[model samples]
Target: MSKIIQSFEAKELKKRPFIIKIADRLTSFFGSISFLILNLLFFVSWIIFNKFDQFPFPMLTMIVSLEAIFLTIIMLVSQQRQAHIATIREELDMQVNKYSEREITKVLNLLKIIAEKQDIKLDDKELDEMLNELELGYIERKLEEQLSEKQKLIIDLSPLNKS
Candidate 1:
């Protein structure tokens, strides 16, 4: 794994509340094949050892249902934490990308100036475009517009939309 990813995970882990940390550990354990095997064994033993007169073992069913409810809550908590971390990571990535874009544009502009001073004629229209600073909001709006148009097209073509 990347050092950056490792560092980010470690930092996030440190910032988590004790309860969240426990939930994360439980989530990890619950997701494992070992947990699945243990659960299967427990269920089998419960069925074989318990001499219940009732056909469908109401006690076992209740225990399983209760476990499911608690497990679902724990999984949701873990997922929420993961989503928060993902959002932070995405924001960090966007900031880095924006900074890089600005730096690259500045460098390109400087190179163009240097080429002009050295009397080296470079005729690249794409380089000229790259030299200009990007309007990120404009780009974002244009992207949104394109996606909206595509979505509308998909909705119109759907069989559910037909009479």
Candidate 2:
């Protein structure tokens, strides 16, 4: 299962464009503690070495501002790429869950048959429900309706919403 997931992730990575790959690498590097320490050291060194008469070094500020802008853009691109991968992963998980549910249902049906063949009297109401085919769309709709109602209740109960 781990190998399968690794292979899936590798395939996803391979499908990304060259530029996105670079951005991902940059994002990893930039998000590291090492990058933070390096930036801190660089800023401290710049301030110490430069004998500027001005209080707020314009050049340093400009350089930092430009770096911030570029890094922000890089981070946004990385976030977009991550969001896409997350969406793909979510879809894959949903498929796996559906497949598992079907397999489990089949197993339960087989167990019920085996129990009857062995002359074992097992009366389970839940088993009857388990044997029935799931209407996924109806279940999803019901779940959404329940969640929406709960969300509305939560919003209404919030202190911010109170007069």
Candidate 3:
């Protein structure tokens, strides 16, 4: 977990322009409850003052629509950054898992050899099978197929079970 945090911190340290940093901070703040309250207060004050025809405030509606458009753009930019980070994390995790699997296989083989040298009989068929090398490509392909099948089932059922 510490390693993961360090990796994420390192990733965040990459150089970004001042405007982008400001935009990121702004978007992050925009998602908070405080921002919601701020907007609520603004709307209430506007109504109390009769700022633009109390009940059917067309100006307020227009302002909100414009704000929505800009917010959507900001959200898209942030999501793109997040998706890039997710891809990097996924690749890192895959590499670590592959390395760990190889190391485990090496250790298991060494233990088996040591047991044999000591004249110790180890007769676990499952352990012997595990000692064999993993076929990562085949496993990955199978996993992808399973995921696609599950996605298809979800897509097929979603409309019929709509809330």
**lDDT on C-alpha atoms for all candidate structures:** 0.93, 0.90, 0.84
List ranges where model 3 is wrong by over 4 Å: 4-8, 158-163
Q: Is candidate 2 or candidate 3 better by lDDT?
A: 2
Better of 1 and 2 by TM-score: 1
The count of residue-pair clashes in candidate 1 stands at 0
Model 3 residue 35 CA deviation in Å: 1.3
Tens digits of per-residue lDDT, candidate 2, 6-110, equal 888899899989999899999999999999999999999888887872558898899999999999999999899889888978888888889989999999999
Q: Which stretches of candidate 2 lie over 4 Å from their true place?
A: 150-163
Per residue, candidate 1 scores C-alpha lDDT tens digits across 78-138 of: 9999999999888888888899999999999999999999999999999988988999999
The number of the candidate with the highest lDDT is 1
Indicate the worst ten consecutive residues by lDDT in candidate 1: 47-56
Supply every candidate's count of residue pairs whose N, Cα or C atoms clash at under 3 angstroms: 0, 0, 0
